[model samples]
Target: MIPHDRPVMAEADIAAAAGMELHTWRRRHGSDFRARVPVVNPGERLRLYDQAQAAAFLEGRPIPPAPPAGEPHPDDLLSTDEVAAALGTDASTVRAYASTGYLPHGTELHGRRYWPRHVVQARIDAGDQRHHPERTGAGRQPGDPRNTAPRGRRTEARVQEVAAELARAEGEALPALTADELAQRYAVSRRTGERLLAAAREYLQQTGRGA
Candidate 1:
């Protein structure tokens, strides 16, 4: 009986040894035997995890793509539809805003009117507060007599002078002046200078002298 048990135990040991040998062979040769074994290095695994996280975070969201570099800023110019969308209104409301001076006046380009995007955005940020009676402080209302129109008239005259100077410098072509040059000449802020230049350009166009 002891001899019989020894042979059975020997058989079990042989089976265990065969299993170990098979595992070792698989480790050495199974890689080449497979058609394609996915090998994910640490960097690739990390990237995959990051992508999964980002995908999860962006789930159920429809985000717009970022604008390309050097592309014109959306705040620089707006289409009628864009203005309407921003204002939570329709295109007709935007047109009315422009006509009523609530929004900046726009120019017709290629038969489509486009507002200066910054101006419209500024007005919107101001809560469409232009000419709001409730927002008016104790200070005199716009066009009040206490405020001298002469100052504005003087500014207008100065604008025309600047325009003439520009015309003289570049002939009737009326070359565009840099913001710094306009500010130095007109004693105005750079922003004010830009507005003045825009107004002057409008004047030139109306008078058929913009050539």
Candidate 2:
């Protein structure tokens, strides 16, 4: 028995009766609603999606950034010219040093020679003075007064005793004993012992006793 002209309630009117607007109710509680929806340009949608995925995967984690471009490693080898520049010397001097075993051997790459930077620096710091023996009294000329000495049987016996003692203690054959060890045994300073040992070893080597 309804009247044919009566107005039917619209969905909006029904929602209003329930204390909400239909559009707002659908936006907030609709079964098909989405939260935090992104609005990206068609051209940028893929990029945005990739970024979102990366961010989600990396959440609560930290990663180190890559090294800057063109940075050199600490252990990188250096050229001979580079080594000379670092040591404040000429390339010829570097070669001479290398020949005398004062410096580490260099490598040839693509027909160019190079030395390790750290190895060169370490040898430099070690005060390797093998290149200039004349400056260190290590190259006394033949027939020099320092080469001649008063020979006595007692002196010969003492030298042999000291040499044997050093060889036994170190378990190695000695062209000569080190100054520090000789000084400890002789109750003398290292410098004095070094002078005496140098002279004795030189004489012994000349005589082919400990060659």
Candidate 3:
């Protein structure tokens, strides 16, 4: 059995714990895995299974009943895939939003990006999702301001501020911020963030603080 340090297991973890080949397990169980196990993150790219329940199933015992379903804790850290699931979209779209500043910057952990549950919830509340039907309402005129492409409110000061912030994250030994992360932090367009990131890196190099 795999070590029980985590409360959940990815598909590979489940197979490892069960002493089965990963491909074999996937081939035999992937389709019905969710149906038979207590899935912790349904409809998400990084689906997790309740470790105890999965172990029980693997051991040929009746799985224990899952707890009542409830909302994720506000402080809960969610992966990009989890956020996409909450937003009723796909991971690529979520990444695109992050890159475009539609979504805010998230924390980086174990080489993956994550956001607090509250952040994802706030986005849902905003009703500004790119895929929302309301975003494509019937047009009455060609000269409508709504037809104008969105632009970033840019300034020299903001660029400097973003550069400083990037330096701070680096000083703290955090993962280097990506353009998407910068856009999320400043609520600017991806192109703007890319420019800011470049300037930040230049600043860091000049200051001998580049990571």
Candidate 4:
């Protein structure tokens, strides 16, 4: 019996361990095998199976039950759907937060970002009424500094400052700041970060410093 802690095995590797050709196993019992042992990674080109569960399925033994699905451990990596559930919001909202750099940059794996349970909980504890302004029970004020995006001479001054920083940067890539990094550094929105980067790049090019 394979130990639960053993590393997951790919389908081909599992077939090789069972002394069956990969094609033969696929033709005969592939569906049954997959149905019995949950695929640890579903969307990847190569599926992986938990070693113990795969072993149990191959041996015609009862497969162990999947882990309970309620509360997750602090260290557990959670999908956007899981995060949505935890936050009492929706997956779209979670994705938006992630895209906007409002959430901590989580681990990216198998073409999906999985945030640690603790980080999601921390966001919950911190409360994001600013992000969801509707919860504030008041319409957005036109004069609100946050609503009135930064512009005019002050913005141009910042652009010039960032462009100077770009000139000082030693890398081949000028303005060495990603949109997300710029947002965090300047305490602005992701959209503002993009605008600042664009303006800075233009400023650098106009001054012949970026070339």
Model 4: per-residue Cα lDDT at residue 133: 38
Residues 11-125 of candidate 1 have per-residue lDDT tens digits of: 1122233353434533653344222222111221010112222222224233223222354454454566667677665554455456546677786532245676566667777
Candidate 4 residue-wise lDDT at 136: 48
lDDT of 2 by residue, 112-202 (tens): 3567656766866877443233433434334322234343543453355455444333322113457886565444578867765765666
Can you tell me which runs of candidate 1 are displaced by over 4 Å? 1-75, 129-211
Q: TM-score per candidate, in order?
A: 0.28, 0.28, 0.43, 0.43
Model 4: residue 167 alpha-carbon error in angstroms: 39
**Residue-level lDDT tens digits of model 3 in 1-211:** 1112336777767777767766778777767776788566665434567777888877888889876655547767788767777887655456556655677877763235678787888889987645333334533124322223253423444455556657645433335668897665444589978988788677678877665
Candidate 4 residue-wise lDDT at 9: 72
- Candidate 4: segments with Cα more than 4 A from true spot: 1-27, 38-51, 55-71, 130-211
Per-residue C-alpha lDDT of model 4 across residues 6-111, encoded as one tens digit per residue: 3567666777778987777777888888777877656443456777788888888999975444444677667666676777655545654664466776776423
- lDDT, each prediction: 0.45, 0.45, 0.63, 0.64
Clashes of 4: 0
lDDT of 3: 0.63
lDDT of prediction 2: 0.45
Q: What is the lDDT, from 0 to 100, of the residue 82 in candidate 3?
A: 72
Residue 29 in candidate 2 has what lDDT?
Answer: 39
Candidates in order: C-alpha RMSD to true structure: 30.0, 34.6, 11.5, 13.3
